[model samples]
Target: MPLGADHLIHANVVCSDFERSLDFYTRLLGARVIGEVFEFDAGEDFMTILGVTGGARCRAALLTWSDDDTATYLDLLAFADGGGHAARTAKDTGLARLGLRVRDLAAALAWIEEHGVPVVGGPVTLTPMPGRQRHVVTIRDPDGTLLTLMEFPERR
Candidate 1:
């Protein structure tokens, strides 16, 4: 039996510049900035659970889409002092990515370009693994995290 997971809670991404990341996700992806938190003191304990002996002293923003009621989120984190690095290509190992579904590929791409956000690649159509044809555009967030906007052919 499959695990009865309902929806995603959140994905944490470390950013080199969180403010920039926050602006980008809101302006470009239309995510609602829900809240922000700064880690300190025993706050480092959480990191220890992840095996990072030193607790992180970072500021993070919780973002979600406007239509989302479940409150699923993407947490953008900027670790203390040692800012995070830019995201590598999607094909690169150990990299995490989020693909968002859009209603209109062309319009979405146009809106994204108008925002002056960097397009990492695509807006190209492909019959990739899911076996369904999809129109896709890959973009790099201000902190270089890879996000793909996807438009799928409506089912018959």
Candidate 2:
């Protein structure tokens, strides 16, 4: 068999408040709630995998939406105990920010600004890989995680 599959299934990020994160994902990112799981009576190792304790209250919601027939999902998790975590900033950490290719950079930046989020970078032009022109803008989420919105027009 090959080392791995050709496509990614999903990505998960920890949140201090699952409900609030769920609301952000649904309202801000336009994702739909798919499912949720609570691990209560599971074994110690299983609980650890779920980031919970034996008698802890853990909530996980799967939110998803489709873009061009591709399913984009977000896993919102919260633990009643001190097991929950927060998103980290891309500049301070080694993680690369999430990049979203959008249809309009200006409109996206306006929407982000309307939501009270500040733009970290510009809606300037750039030469993408190879020989294409692209416009990009960066914005920070409520938790300071960076997200880049890229726009590639039909002709520039």
Candidate 3:
């Protein structure tokens, strides 16, 4: 028998500044805020949950790219006492980046450039098969979290 894992709920990104990161996601990726930003103090429950001691607090909100209720969400969270830094490189391992599939890479790039967001990597073409092609680029958020935008050839 195999463990029944259905789907990914959300990936949490610990931001240095919650509002800035939220704004970046909304403005650049068109992520809509699902609800109000809330904060809570972490007691023994959070300590066990996050593997930390007492006195940890968090500010958080869920963001979605679409209006579907079952859609996966981006959980943007920040800690009151957290002073951690982001992963320096994708090779550093855990939660490297969030990859989003877009319909138009050119339009996305244009909007990103117009907003003064630097493109860290290519809009390079990837041709795995004769008819299959993918265009990709990498950009960072306000907290330097890598986001990969990929556009694939439309299917018939």
Candidate 4:
């Protein structure tokens, strides 16, 4: 069945700490919370929706970028029990990465460095079109989730 969808409404990033995740996305990447943080015992429906059989407690916050052209929603979730496990980069399969775009790639990478976040790799030029060149970088978030950041180069 082809599910007709408008666009990606939100993506979930399970974290170990709500504050840390919030700071990482909001403080670091400039995403603003769209709604209040929700806290409750992870009911059967929640666990089911998350594709899990257990884990009863969860706290989640909806996030969106202020500078983003699209809504670009992200849900920063903190789950209890094994749900709070740090991200794994091993070959074990799952949602391995999340991509993001920023206005100033260099400054964003610098922010990651200044804040002591692990950089997966240095920035590389993407589309080297004159007057519209682009760059990309890979880095690890607070929970080790890999994120790719892209931006247009500054004209000098």
Provide TM-scores for the models.
Answer: 0.80, 0.73, 0.90, 0.81
- Candidate 4 off by > 4 Å: 67-70, 84-87, 90-92, 128-133, 153-156
User: What is each predicted model's overall lDDT from 0 to 1?
Assistant: 0.76, 0.68, 0.85, 0.79
lDDT of the structure predicted as candidate 3: 0.85
Cα distance off (Å), candidate 3, residue 33:
1.3
lDDT of 3 by residue, 1-156 (tens): 878988898888889988888888887789988877789886788778877767678898898887885689988988889777845667877778889988899999999999999999998998878978889999988888889999986642
Model 2 Cα lDDT, one tens digit per residue, 41-142: 335886688675575566777666664335766556666664534556655656657776777778777877888778888888998667788898888655
Rank candidates by lDDT, best first: 3, 4, 1, 2
- lDDT of residue 60 for candidate 2: 78
Alpha carbon lDDT at 77, candidate 1: 75
- Lowest summed lDDT across 10 adjacent residues in model 2 is found at 34-43
lDDT of 4: 0.79
Let me know the TM-score candidate 4 reaches against the reference structure. 0.81
Of candidates 3 and 1, the better by TM-score? 3
Which candidate do you rate higher for TM-score, 3 or 4? Answer: 3
